[model samples]
Target chain A: MNNKITQNLYLLPYALWIVLFVIAPLLLVLYYSFFDIEGHFSLMNYMNFFTPVYMKMAFSSFWYAFLITFISLIFAYPTAYLLTKTRHKQLWLLLIIVPSWINLLLKAYAFLGIFGTKGIANSFLEAIGVGSKQILFTDFSFIFVSVYIFIPFMILPIFNSLNEMNPSLLDAANDLGASKWTTFRRVIFPLTINGVKSGCQVVFIPALSLFMLTRLIAGNRVITLGTAIEQHFLVTRDWGMGSTIAVFLIIIMFLIMSVTGNRKRGV
Target chain B: MSKLVRFFFAIILVSAVLFYTVHELNNSEGYSGRNTLTIYNWGDYIDPQLIKRFEKETGVKVIYETFDSNEAMLTKIEQGGTTYDIAIPSEYMIDKMRKERLLIPLDHSKLPNLHYIDKRFMDLPFDEDNKYSVPYFWGTVGIVYNSKMLGGKKITSWNDLWDSDLRNKILLIDGAREVMGMGLNSLGYSLNDTNHNHLHQAKRKLDLLTPNIKAIVGDESRLLLENEEASIGLVWSGVASEIMSENKNLEYAVPKEGSNLWFDNMVIPKTAKNIKAAHKFINFMLDPKIAAKNAEYVNYSTPNKHALSYMPKGTVNDERFYPSPELTRKLEVYENLGKKNLAYYNELFLEFKMHRK
Candidate 1:
């Protein structure tokens, strides 16, 4: 009991931090969502959010998030699989994670230089007699950079899951005459479902709120809920409206997590 | 052994926290009982040396703070945790604040150098009588184009943006108000026209230009232009002048059609605790030599008529910085559209931004 009490004491600081920063700020956002700028009690903020324009924005935000999550998964799973199968697995994994050491904003800015009209992408295209094509401010560059920035989040979790896979189970399947692809499909893939689901949650939730990247990389062609909330609070000074949008985003994130996180936990 | 080191770190951390807490509490009590004037302005808008000079001239200690945008400044002032003696907000914001009675009127006696203000900058729509504001810096919205790429062709009118030859080479300012104002001006309409149909028409014209536009940029426009990635960019006169100074191949022109003539004005808020010092500071900034120094430092034009004579010989003659008379006659300053009109513009322009096709 004394040891348990000491361990609990160790957790006290982190618990206090969570309550102060995370829970308190979220509670504040929830409270402000119900009030207008003048401190009047009103549902107009929420009512305004129910419009078709915002509905379309919410749809696009989720679709983009889903697309980015899906793309990151495709790239990550293969890289992770290769990492697990590699001779020097730790070194290869470290190499894959090297890009994450730099900030996302820096990475996005670097991509801007690489894909600019006078940049490497266009220069190479021209060299091949294809002539220059517009790359910056396009949907392609935005999606490309987002995938680049977020692949690590997806990879690290998947790698953890893959690394922990019981090799005996895989060997048993192999001894039973199951081919490599078949064993991966039936045995390895099923056991790693937890990681895949959790990794998707990690990427998808933040992807919905990528406000700055959409502006920097996409050049305003892509407007997510994150950007909408920014426009309301930063540009329009409509904090109530911003909080309302933020509350909706929080709810959507929860809904996505519950659906992904709670299923088949025994695995 | 590690536990002893950790305990030592804990003690040091606690001491640091206590030190800062005591230090901040001391600062809040005022510095040695000296008179302090707090001025809030856009980041890097004023020269630091001028603030020191003002502090030296007057026995007043100056505390300066900065915000990145007008909206942020308004929000900060309204929330009222901190009081600022003076703030330099743009002209349209002055109009909004005047409506809110957030500003206190200036006493002409306290600001005798007000006479040096150019006649053109005086008696404008935002503050016609200069009741609550004093002009600080002014610039015009204009085009900065690569002259080498243009083959010496003069790109004067806003219509040149729609020219097919410049397709995928033109950069528009990412701001909705700036871009929409140009669209309205190109159509020979008022830049401040809040009429619904007129706004939609401007949006329509803006939508058409999307095909030719390479990128809509904020600060990155400078990098893009410098790299020759973008041939022409719609930019502020001050930025254009800076660009021209860097690259001789670039030239700036005020479109034949009108564009925004922006102003940053110094105003004393109603909550100001140092009104007298604020007035003195404003007056000092209006002084010929001081104003010229400020103008040269910030690379923006001075509203003081006498300041021009004190500046570099060709500073006033630089047509890029100061538009020609014909173009100046057509330039329009943005007016503060009230909450309703502002909301409408944001919504419409947001739609335009999202549907960039």
Candidate 2:
């Protein structure tokens, strides 16, 4: 009882911070979503969210985020699979995660240097006489940088689930004369659905709201939903509209979580 | 099974806490007690020595803070946490604050050095008769080009940006108003053109330049030029000044066709606790030596005619910093286009960004 009480006391500041920072701000956004600029209750903000331009923006943001999530999964899966099979697996996992410790903005700026016209990539291209390429501010650079940034999120959970798989069960499937591909598909893959769900849940939501990448590396060319919210809040000074967009973003994120938050727990 | 579910929750909760805490820490507010002159200005906008001198000379505490954008400054003032005595806002924002009564009328007697303000920089639309704001820095939107790539052709007009030879070599300013204003000026319309049809025409003109364009960017425009990623960029005079200082081959010009002339001005907010100290601070800034020091430190043009001679050795007669009257005749100032039109302009810019083929 005494130990439990001390632990609760230790978490008190964090709990208070969450209430003050997280819960209060979320409630404020929800409140703002239903109002206009004049402090009157209205659905105009929500109504405006469905306008043609906004609808198009929402679709594009989702498409780009989906692309990012899908691409990160493709790259991260094999790496995570390899990690589970490695001798020094812990060290390899540490290496994979260590780069993520660097600041996102710093990494993006460094990439800008690497991707600029006089950058190493372009310099190499010119050295080979393929000619310099306009790679910076292109969609390829934006997605490539995003995939680099978000890959760890896709890898960790999948690693956990793969590492947790019952070796005896795999051996049993092999002993039952199931072919390698078939056993892996019908047995290992289905069992690891929980990990995949958990990983997707981690990666998908933030991919929707990633702003700095869209701005810095993409040259403000890609208008993600997060960028739109920033414009409304800071540039346009429309708190109501920004909040409405944020609310919709939360709804989309929640939907993503639900779809990926596996209900069948006994995987 | 439950452990995985709990693990996912813990991951999200930790990230949420991290993001919220970092954001909060970055924007943590500061307060001033009494007899303090609190001034809010742009980041790295004014020299530290000036703030120290002001404090030392006046026997008053100085609580200085900085914001990066005009909109951010406006948001903080509207939210009303810190009691900022004096704020340096851009002309359009100065106008908005005056209209919104966020600023108080200045007492000219307290500001005796107001006479040192160049007649050319005064009596502007943003603060008519110098009621609310005193010009801090004035500059124009212009082209900064790498002469090495121009091949003996003197690029002197906005049309130069549309040249097919400069394909994917032109970098435009990132802001909605700046980009749309460039489009409007290129079409022989006013930079502050409000007509719906004129805006559409500007958009069409921009679409043609899109093929020749490198990217729409801000802050990094100078780096882009230095890196040779872009041969020419439509950027602010202040940034252009910084660029020329870095790379000798780069040159800046206020296109003959004209461009937006912008000014940052200082004003006393209505929430001022020490209005007298605020006036003293503004007057101190107008002191020729102090104004020169500020201009030298910030690398932006000063509007103090008296301070021109005192400008740091190389900056005074720099044509990029001081345009002739003939050039001034071709320039226009950006006016607050109202909430609806500003939104419309932003939408247009975003649409253009989205449809990048």
Candidate 3:
């Protein structure tokens, strides 16, 4: 009984934090979603969300988020795999994480300069005989910047799962006359599937709500659900519609988690 | 280990509680005995020296805060934690705030310097009879183009933006009202047009200009144009002035089709803790010399008629920033379009934005 009391005491702060920050704000958003612009309680915002315009925006936002996550995975998996083989693996991991430690806005500004028409990317293209092109504000620039920002997040989890794997399993596969590719595909991948799922979860949710990158890098060409929410809340002062979108985003997040969530341990 | 963890949690919880208590105590006691005025305005919109002058002149401690947008300022005031003495909002927002009862009706007796304001800027559509708002700075939205890059073609009208030669060379301002206003102006419709058919027609017209548009940007539109990244930009007259100062190749033009005439005004929120100080500050800012200093420093047009004499001859006479009366007649100010109509404008603008190739 005494041990249980101590454990509960230790858990109190975290519980309080979750209640105050996470649960309260979520409840507020849900409450706000039921109202219209005039503060009258109505289902108008929810009804509006189902319209073709918002539906198309939601679909496009999903497509962009999916593309960003997929690209981040493709780049991160190899980088993390190679880093694990390096002698100074932790140092390499530290280097990868160092960029993430910098402010997101600063890194975005750096990309704005680098991908600009007269920037290094275009200058290099010119030197290579491709000539300068409109690199900034394009879909390519947006995806590239997003993938660059999210790669470290994707790699860290996969790196940890790879590190935690038993070396004996790999040796056993080799001893059993299984090729390296077969070992990786059949054994290594399944064990680290949890890591991949978690990594994707970390990247995908934030990617869905990306508002700043859409403006700064994409140059307002792309409109995510987050951008729409920001527009409604700040620009339009239609907090009800913004809240309705938030509620929907939360629902979608839960649906995504269940689909990609860890299953029963053995089965 | 468990004991250590419990100890840490206890420390965190206690510290959080103590922090909250101290913060509350400081807030309550800080203003009770002090002569402080909290003024909320746009970032870098005023001269810091003028603030000091006001403080010294009135012997009131000035607490200055800045917001990037009128909506953000409104949100803060609506949330109602800290009481602000004064706030500056644009014309359309002033109308919205007046309707919401967020503004305090000005006592004309307190603001004796109101007579210094230009008659041209007075009794406008947004706030007729100048009930709550006093004009601070006013400007128009126009095209800022690089002369050398335009291939000897002069940009005189909004129709020039649609030229196929300008394809992928234009950067538009990232604002719903401003961008939508551009569309409406090009279609010979009022910028504040709430007609469903007219707005839709504007959207269709804007859709055709997408191929020429490089991107929609905010403050960075100036930087892009300065570096010659894009040849032309649809920007505010003030931003265009700043850009022109930086890059001599750039020139601003008020399109023949006409565009938005926006004004930023000073007003007191209804929740003002120091109304006397707010009025004093407003009167101080309206003084012709102070107004001219602010105008020159911020590169925006002064709405104070007497301030024009105090300003540089070249800048005051610049037609791009200060359009002639004939051109001014063509321009229209954005009206408060109420709640539902404003949201519709934002929605239509969003649809136009998402229609990218």
Candidate 4:
């Protein structure tokens, strides 16, 4: 009981901070979602959320996030596997992690240098007589930047999971006459599923709310729920509507996580 | 553990917490001294040298803050959190702030350099008699195009954005007000129109144009022009000038339908602590030499007649910088739409954004 009291005291600061900053703000968002500027309680904000335009935007945001998660999973799994098997594992990990230190906006800006009309890609294509002009500021650029920014998130988790896997289990499977493919399917895949899910959670949530990169790379051609929320709060000065959209986003995220969690638990 | 090691660890942790506490306390106090003045303005909107000059002249330390949009600035100010002495807001926003009792009216006697302003821009709708705000810079919203890509066609009006040939080849401002205002102006409606039918019609036209938009952009016209990511875009004159400076192929022109003529003004908010220092700083910036130098650096048109006289003859004569009086007559100033109208406009903008097509 004394040790338990000491541990609670140690946890107090962090618990308070979480409650104050995260939970309090989330509750405020929920409350504001139901109230208008005049402090009248109404469902107008939520009903407005159901509009076809916002519905489309919400769908697109989820769809793009899912696509990015799937792509990152495909790319990161092999990369993590290769790094684990490599001799210079630390050096390879350092290389992958290095770009993560750079500001996300700077990374998006750098994409402009490589993909802009006068950028290297276009110049090279023009020189080789392959293509005519730039590829920057399109939907492709948006996806490309999103994938690049999020790949690190995907890789680190999977890498840690792979590193934690017991080599003895693989050896035992081999001894049982399990082929390489069969062993990977039965042992490796099942074991790494949690890491993959957590990685998706990390990448999907952030990618869904990515406003700056979308604004920069997509040239605002693609509008997401995140951008709409920003516009409402910052530009329109309609906090009621902005908070409503944010609440909707949180609910959708909750639903997605719960469903995914249940599926992972096989319940 | 050794007593010495435990003592060292406790010292390190205590000192770290102490340092963080001091930092937070300092930040919370903000500009406290009588010698300090905080100015909040748009990003990259002013010449840094002008602020330095003001500080040097008045012996007041100037802390500069920036926001990308008027609404963002208003939101920050409305929270009653940040104590800013001077803020630069657009004309309509100035009116809004005045209505909200957020602004402190200026004493013209304190601002001796107010005489430098041209007679034409005075007594404007937003702040008639120049009570609450002083005009800093003025410009028109217009289209910037690459002449090389338009097939030698002069992209004269907002209608050019909808030309079938330009499909998937144009860009527009990401700002709802600017774009929707342009659409309204193109349809012979007021830029500040709040009529639901007018807004819907403008939105429908924008719907047709959305698919053609290569990207919507704000404030990155320099990159867009240099990279050729867009052939034409709706941009402010200051940005247009920057684009033209970087790329010779780039050109800016006001649409034949007339475009938004906006003026960013300097004002003192009610929460200002150092009103005297703020007034002195404003007068310092209004000095003709200082104003002209700022205009030259920022590439925006100054509202000061004396500043114009001090500028190079060619710059003053440049049509892009100083449009013909006839062209000036065609430009319409945006007015602050009342609350109900603002809500209606916001709804339309939100609906359009939600609708993918």
What is the per-residue lDDT of model 2 for residues B1-357, given as tens digits with 9 covering 90 to 100?
Answer: 999999999999999999988657434522223477889988778989998788778877788898867888998898898799999999999989999989999999999999999998899877889999899998998888999887756788888788889877888777888888888988899988999999998987888887787777767777889767788998888888877888888888888777988899999998799999999999999999899988888888999999988866567777767887776877898898888788778878877776665
List the per-model TM-score of the A chain.
0.92, 0.89, 0.96, 0.92
Which residue runs does candidate 3 get wrong by more than 4 Å? A1-18, B1-35, B52-61
Clashes of each: 0, 0, 0, 2
The DockQ-based CAPRI class assigned to model 4 is medium
Which candidate wins on lDDT? 3
**What local lDDT score does residue B31 receive in model 4, on the 0 to 100 scale?**
25
| Superposition error at B189 for model 2 (Å) | 1.5
Each prediction's RMSD to truth: 4.6, 6.1, 4.0, 4.0
Ranking by DockQ: 3, 4, 2, 1
- Comparing candidate 1 with candidate 3, which one achieves the higher DockQ? 3
Q: What is the DockQ of each candidate?
A: 0.44, 0.47, 0.74, 0.51
Tens-place lDDT per residue, model 3, A18-98, is: 999999999999999999999999999999999988998899899999999999999888888898899999999999999
Q: What is the lDDT of residue A225 in candidate 3?
A: 93
Q: What does candidate 3's lDDT look like per residue over B307-332, in tens digits? A: 99999899989887887788788888
| Poorly placed runs, candidate 4 (over 4 Å) | A1-8, A37-39, A126-129, A262-267, B1-34, B324-326, B350-357
What DockQ was computed for model 4?
A: 0.51
Name the 10 consecutive residues with the lowest summed lDDT in model 2 chain B. B25-34
TM-score of each: 0.85, 0.86, 0.91, 0.92
Tens digit of lDDT per residue, candidate 2, span A85-150?
Answer: 999999999999998999998999999999987889999999999998889988899999998998
What are the runs in model 1 whose C-alpha is more than 4 Å off? A1-52, A85-98, A126-131, A264-267, B1-40, B47-66, B81-86, B104-115, B123-125, B128-131, B268-284, B324-327
- Docking tier of model 1: it is acceptable
